[model samples]
Target: MFVGHYAAAFALKGREKEASLGWLFIATQFVDILFFPFVVWGLETMEFVPGYTETNDFKMEFPFTHSLIGSILWAIAFGGIFFLLFGRKKTSGKSIAFVLGLGVLSHWVADLFVHTPDLPLLHGEPKFGFGLWHNKAATFALEALVLLLGLWYYLKRTVAKNKFGKFVSIGFVLFLLLVNYLNYYVLPANHDIIGLTISALVSYFLFAGLAFWVDTKRT
Candidate 1:
């Protein structure tokens, strides 16, 4: 669920004319942006304990950030801030904020597929997940499809309209795929917390940097 989060935001571009696609992209990964630092600071917990499932090699209890209710609250708070910053209720930006919030929530939905029943439905009682991670091929294929198809839709809808924006869109998606490979394949095999944290920071930089570049060039 690392880069799959941004897929939701990219997909939203098809619906909203004024939506800052990059901002929506940022909104999607907001939880992981916080989760990594929290992991280092001991506010969250995860370990590289292989064999927890047939495929997933890590176990996590990232309640403060990834909890269903917690995500909803953060979505609203961030959406309100988005409204204050660049959105107006009378205009599309507000709706963009709401969609961006859903993009944030989409992270949790994707996580529900990959995580091992650790995702909480609420704060407590009867945790829910389908344990799709145990089914490795299905999980990875679904995630890759979401990542590619979402970007495909974004390209189909927006790329032909502006030159700089077109290049930026393609570059952002390519960069994201490269990084997802490093995170999902290379770095996970390395298993160094410092390395992992640095990787997480690098990803945030890409997600944000590309967003800023595209936003600046976009009409």
Candidate 2:
């Protein structure tokens, strides 16, 4: 889902009026930030279980960060910190922070479509998802479309406020998105723990870099 998740924040770009680019970026990926640490701590888990479906091949055992309630709780916790730190100086700070939390929660919502039945409704009740990725080409197409459309909308609604800024942000997004497809669908296979850790770490790195670059270009 990579860049497609940006829709969570992009939904409010110009609408929010004065939201910071960093928080929006943070919102979409806040779960992953929690996810990686939780993964390392063995509090959550994944397996490259081949043939979990026809094409999709990953199984997740994530409760601390991926559960519906856990995600909302994490969103509030992160956004609250954002509010306290930034809202004291400006009212829009809290608004932006609040919206960004919803952005964080949006990840799980979006995942529900493409993921396997690994995503739980609550902490334990029967896990569920539509398994959209089983149709590889369609899954990729939808993911790419969301990223491009959201990013295009983001660029159109806001000026770069600096020379070549929009181009730079677009450039980074393009590169990172390509990298994900390459690493995920094209790269050499590594069906092991090292492989899993590397993938998660790279995902974080790619998104964090894109966020940092976009933050700098914000109007």
Which lDDT value does model 1 have at 165? 67
Cα lDDT listed for each candidate: 0.74, 0.73
| Residue pairs with backbone atoms closer than 3 Å in model 1 (clashes) | none
Query: Highest lDDT: which candidate?
Result: 1
Over the stretch 1-219, how does candidate 2's per-residue lDDT look in tens digits? 666677656655655757765567667877876776677678888677777754446677898888888888888987788788777688578787778788888889888888877777567778878888787676777777877777777777777868878588688668767875785579765567655666766766567666766756766
TM-score of each: 0.84, 0.87
lDDT tens per residue, model 1, 34-126: 888989999888798867765556787887888999888888888888888878755676787888778778888878877777887565556
Q: For all the candidates, what are their Cα RMSDs to the real structure? A: 2.6, 2.3
lDDT of 1 at 60: 77
Cα deviation at 68, candidate 2, in Å, is 1.0
